[model samples]
Target: MKILVLAIDRDDDFGVKAGVKGPVIGRDSCLDAAVKLSLADPEDSDANTLFAAIKLYDELKKKGEFDEVEVALITGHPNVGVESDLRLSKQLDEVLKKFPADGVIPVTDGAEDEQIFPIITSKVPIISTRRVVVKQSPGIETTWYIIVRYLKEMMSDPEVSKVVLGIPGLIVLLYGIAKIISIKYPPSAQIVSSTVTGVVMLIVGGYFFSKGFRLKPITSLVRIVSRGLITFIGVVTGFIVMLGGAINVYLTLESIAENMIGGIPTSELIAFLIYLNAFNKYFILGLGIMISGKIIQEYLRRDPHIWYYIASFLMLPAFWKVIDLMTIYSNPLIKKSPETLIAGVLLVLIDLTLSIIISIKLREEVKKWSSASS
Candidate 1:
């Protein structure tokens, strides 16, 4: 097996500190980088990660477990969040073009770099993952070093700073709102709770909006928006319908509970509410449709694995409704019906048949395509 030992530096911290940027290929290059990086910034975690990958490569070569073994290091932009991940993907693409490997073993020092697991696995199969850490002397001094390092990162990194600042900002805003409300009239619990909820929603909306703006992939919003329209529309439409249905259901239930609506049997009214609640099934249906659209999009891009995934996921709504209906009909505690039970069994058979067919077809397609590609 020809294997690659992959080291992730998602934010280029190691390269920036050690003055070694881009993909550092092979055992010698990576080992040299680890030494230089460790010397340049002895405290950098990426230095430790690099050393681990080099060590792993040496061990595998010495043990003669693999016919060929290589090592690589890839980094990304500092400030871009998902953009940095995309850049990392591009770098991996370049590495694959030059030096293809059967599988990769990703090595990371901490959570920050390890967060990009999907990016690495998407490009090549991962045999295993390794996380390296430099053992620290156990003392108050080590504790202080960890604290200062974390605080400095949180303060400097926008990703961490936003959450840290948002919490206190929310508290201050809610307190001010409560103080004003109290001056006019002593606020009730409802008022305080509503105020806090509204503030939280506002903050969450702002954060997502800012995050969306930061996704600078392709550097063109038009293309991204155009491609994402189906999902965007589906989600927005589903949310609108769900919101209206929830409000309508709540009022209807409240009226029934208070006996405000007359001339309707309570049992029938409750059953009717159950049927109305099922209207939210369209919300799930819309999501399934959006996912199907996404699968088609991926298919157009010629990703083989997505075909198998889509074949399974396309059954989402059917699987949901069939299982729900079957459970309702088969429960002996709730008046049993032979007719509904038989219907449920037939539906289950149909679902199983379709699933089996799709699975077989997917298996064939994957085998054929894998042979052609290889």
Candidate 2:
């Protein structure tokens, strides 16, 4: 039986530190790799792992337990995840091609290196596994060193750092802002600390809730903005216009409430209709502009969804007319006009008919373009 002893460097300490490439086959070559690695980083555990594999190779040769015994060292990329594993797999294939071992004895310095065991076993059965733990001085200093090293690594990882560092940074920022506000307005100073604390807790809770639900509003917005600059600008402008309309309603809210006091049951309903009337025109106009920008963007991209946006844009005027009719009818104070009602109904029907016709025509054009492309 031919047996192969495999020494793994999953993080490519051999290549990165010693400037040696992978699949370092033969007893002599492995020894050379070990010497180079030791010279580069004397305390590297991978160097000890290589020496251990060489020692196992010698022992197996002396026992004559197998017809042939070969020791080889394989190195991976420094990236240490998919990139590292892929390199290890390719190097393993190269080693197997050279010496088709019936079984493999994997020698690893740590659990990270041992992760490649399943990959090796899929190609050849694992006869045994040797884990090389470098001997170190026993003391609190060593324990502290290990803890610090892992903490540093955790902070260096982007995903971990977001939670470990980001939340604290956010808290500090909020606290600073609260202090500035308290100093600027002394009368409200007493409540600032508690308010800041509540705000911090609320923000932190929201962050975790969004993470747990996999909600990525910022990422989605970025993706949309990346698709077209015009679309982004249009959406922002539309939002600003709608916000202005809402602000107007808020500023007039006290007067509207005063008018409703001691009035009929329909007084509140009439006040709501007035607020809607004040906001609907701006809303419809802003929404139409936003949809128009999207239509232009989709048209440029030759996307089929352009027709849907066009239809939506055409219907906005109809929606505005419907809101106007509702406001006029709900308030008894306004004189009812048959001519005004008939005009509003006709306008809605005209908008609907136009939308349907334009959508059908645009869809036919899109179908023709597709047919021509094919």
Candidate 3:
């Protein structure tokens, strides 16, 4: 069996900064690049990665661990996130065709490089991953310098800056705009706030425009967020439905009060009471829809933990009904009438039945969905 000693550069910094292009193959090529980079920039992590990879290759060669073993060094596209990783993955695949291996020992210096773990694992089994860390003793000045450098870089990089500044910047802009639009608030405050907000936005936008022109894991994160938003919309819609039902309940209560003052018949009064008590059916339906939506989201995502959510949500209506019974006993208005209790029981039963039916239907739907997706 062939074994590979794989080295990765997720950001192609080796190529961009060190002038070391990849896929650099074989023990000699990998070692030469490592030595050159280490000499050029001692602080560069890529240099350390290369040194570790070359050492691993030499040791295995000296020991004769396997009959057929090969080492490879690959760098990704510059600036781009997951796209850079994708570039690395594609290059690795091509290199494998030339020197095919069964498994790999990946050498990475830190977590940034290791983020490509999934990409590598898909192509070849990882026997073990090696991480090489450089130790340093820094003076106070050096420590301060490092912190300052990091902050400068963070300000320069839009990917980092967006998270740090986006929310606050947007809030300031919105607040300023609201002030500008309002006739009641002081014009001086509005002008000051808007000017400050505009300046912040300009700085942020400039940084983003500068950096983003050059920039994907970012793309993956975006997609994940999009899915979460869709699920959230479903849950929010369910709540809105229930809110409408609550408004109806308030209106119904008002009508009941009017009837009490107008000397309405006893039969009509009982009917109105029944209708008032039954207003909760919409709430129950809304909750069921929300749970169903959550379950569907998990199921569609193929998450293995969805069963736990489903099981709990399935019993939610019954649990709520029990809580309601306890609440009703404490209330004097409904405690005297057994009809409300009977109605509650029937509604609870109906909800459970509907929940079961929907659960069964969703199971079938999920199965079909799984089959289609596969």
Best by lDDT: 2
Q: By TM-score, who's the top model here?
A: 2
- Cα lDDT tens digits for candidate 3, 196-269: 67876776676567567843436645775687765666677789988888777666765654443343324654
* Best of the two (1, 3) by lDDT: 3
> How do the candidates rank by lDDT, highest first?
2, 3, 1
- Could you tell me which 10 consecutive residues in candidate 3 have the lowest summed lDDT? 257-266
lDDT of each: 0.72, 0.86, 0.74
Determine the C-alpha RMSD for candidate 1 after optimal superposition of all C-alphas.
Answer: 19.9
Residue 256, candidate 3: how far off, in angstroms? 37
Query: What TM-score goes with each of the models?
Result: 0.40, 0.49, 0.40
The worst-scoring run of ten residues by lDDT in candidate 2 lies at 257-266
TM-score of 2: 0.49
Compose the digit string of candidate 2's lDDT tens values, residues 196-292. 9999999899889989999987898899889897888889888888999888876876565446343433556667777787688889878977887
